[model samples]
Target: MSKAYVFTRNGGPEVEALVDRDMPTPGPGELLVAVRAAGVNPVDWKLRKGYTRPGSVPQPFPTVFGSEAAGVVEAIGPGVGGFAIGDEVFGNPVAGGYAEHTLLPVAVTAHKPAGISFADAAVLPVAAATAYDGVRQLGLAPGATLLVTGAGGGVGSAAVQLAQHAGVRVIGVASASKKAFVESLGAVHVEPGGGLADRVRALAPGGIDAVFDLAGGDTLREAALLLADPAALISAGDKQLVAELGGAPVERARTAAVLVAVAGLVVAGALRTHVTGTYPLSAAGEALRAVEDGHALGKTVIEVTV
Candidate 1:
């Protein structure tokens, strides 16, 4: 039996337990991989608390809690191509990532290069890839002013650096505690909470050209005030609320090619994955809490061994 961190029901952290289960086999166009590392994101816990994306069905109970992982392929599924056993790869998990083994769809999977660690690759599929996609969707020109909400966290942090690297001027909204950290990524760090619009306006006296929000609710509302063109505002957080503000939600290009491109950016040093915490399979709950509490810096990961 393979070890996995699972939740038999939809509830709080208490619902999760570390247990062993039969190994999962790959389905068509999938790869059965020996998981080396798993990325923890806010979505993991949200889904655990029963938050299913619109139009998506809820997964069955006793579900494992992870969406992205990197590892060595052990078996290949039918109708798959361009990969073989023993390929070190990373991608969205077909089952889940918080386990000794999981399945990865070849469509979104990419071979992990030697230069990148499994932990780093694990975080990219979800966080870094989302940031790359949102930035690409905006299609901001060089020197364009973009404001990124929740800049202290994973997607926000990635957006700041990626936008800056693409010659876009970024004003990052985060907590005061992460000012130095955000500034380190070449963004003008501004704290959130009341007066957000004033602070952002003060930084970019002219105005903001676009907003890429990771923090929903009030932050997104305030961010909307900075841009004259509402279409310039997009969020990965709350789609309904963003729509009310005349902005759209992030349209993710969830494909293996996008994964490959972002991974390439990381290897080229144009993008970076800031994994601030690592937990073992046994500490999956704590690893998840780090992201769920809304205080984690960059990304948190679960490192598994053979």
Candidate 2:
């Protein structure tokens, strides 16, 4: 039997309880993976707490809660291609990632790179996808300046690295404690308090070429005020704020397309994945709490296997 974390009712992290179940079989166009590591994101908690809308699948009691993970493919469905048993892969499993095994759609799973460990690759699908969408939306050119708020968090950190790789100057807004960490990712760090727009102006003087608002509270509003001419901005957190700023909502399809492109980049060694912490599958609740508590410096993952 495979072990999985499931939420029988919408509530806190405590609602996530582990249960033993039979391993799932892959459908046509699916791959069954023996999960090694599962990436934990804010959305996981959001869904669990009913902060975000539930998916189309009816939430039967004991529904699995995780999505992204890295593992070795134990079996591949008849119609699938480009993968085989024993292949190392990473993907967003639509249902239960916090498990010993899970099934993923063939399109979502990608061959894990030789240089990337399962723990690191597990951090890719959700946070990397969000960061990729932000960068892609801006079409940020070399020498351009990009500002990212909440740079200490997973998606924000990924944005900083991806933007820097594109030859754009990156300015990251984080708390004082996270300044050095953000700087290590090749971004100039700014403290979160004060007139953020004014501080950004003091640094860039000419305004930012693009902005990525991962912290969607007041930071997004500040980003709108500091945009350069013909501004481009992407908000990963709040759709209402995007609409309020007259910015386009970052759609899931666009995010997925960006992730596919970035996955190629990761495979090519053009980008790096940052994993801050790993927990045992039994400690999945603690991992989610770390993400919810907003203290994690990078992606937090649950290690389901050695």
Candidate 3:
């Protein structure tokens, strides 16, 4: 038997709870993983709270909550290749990751880097991939100035580092407490408030070359207003806003591609994972609460070692 975090109904965090179930066997073209760590994201709670769009739900009842995880390949399904039992791997599986065992497609899984730990490897899928996609969408050139809203969050922090890696100047928007951290990532921090655009303009008078809005509210609107001509804008948070700015929706295929690129970066030592806190599988509720309260500095992960 394997323990998994499953949501039986659509409601708040209270409605979604962890339960023990029989271990699942991988199907054709799939790989069964013994999950070592599971990265928690806002989406998990959003889905539990019924904030997710109807189309995003693949199953009705007893749905799994997580998508990203790192583990050792315990078994490979028929016809699967390029992997073996005991191979260390990390990827976003189709089912819930907040469990001791999970199944994922072979295409989405990748070999873990030798230098990275399981905790670090688990943080790369969603956050790092989203940042990569946003940066790629902008086609940002070297020396170009890029504005990243919500610059202290997971995707935001990742964007700050990835932008700097690409030789782009970054202006990060974050709260007062996160100012130093954002700056450490090589971005000029702007406090979030009414005068945010003014502050950004003060930093770069001619305006920015691209805008990556990870926080979607007034900051996103401000980003749209400040975009340079023929500018690139990408948002991983708001689909409606993305459409309004003529940007495409972030789909599974695109997400997978971005993750693959991020994995390559981890292998090359150009990127690093940042995990703020970790919780045992039994404390999944507390972990979700921490994420909802916005207390974590980086990715909050659940360690399912049992």
lDDT winner among the candidates? 1
Residues 169-250, model 1: lDDT tens digits: 9999989888888988989988899999998888789899999999999999998988889999999999899999999999
> Which regions in candidate 1 have their CA more than 4 angstroms from the true location?
none
- Roughly what TM-score does model 3 have, to 2 decimal places? 0.93
Report the C-alpha lDDT of model 2 over 60-160, residue by residue, as the tens digit: 76877677888999988889888889999888895879999999887777788777888888888888877877787788789999988989998899889
> lDDT per prediction?
0.92, 0.82, 0.80
* lDDT (Cα, 0-100) at 38 in candidate 3: 89
The best-first sequence of candidates by lDDT reads 1, 2, 3
RMSD per candidate (Å) reads 0.8, 2.2, 2.0
Stretches of candidate 3 off by over 4 Å are 53-57, 246-260
List clashing residue pairs in candidate 1: none
Clashes of 3: 0
Q: Which stretches of candidate 2 lie over 4 Å from their true place?
A: 53-58, 228-231, 253-264, 267-269
Q: How well does candidate 1 match the true structure in TM-score terms?
A: 0.99
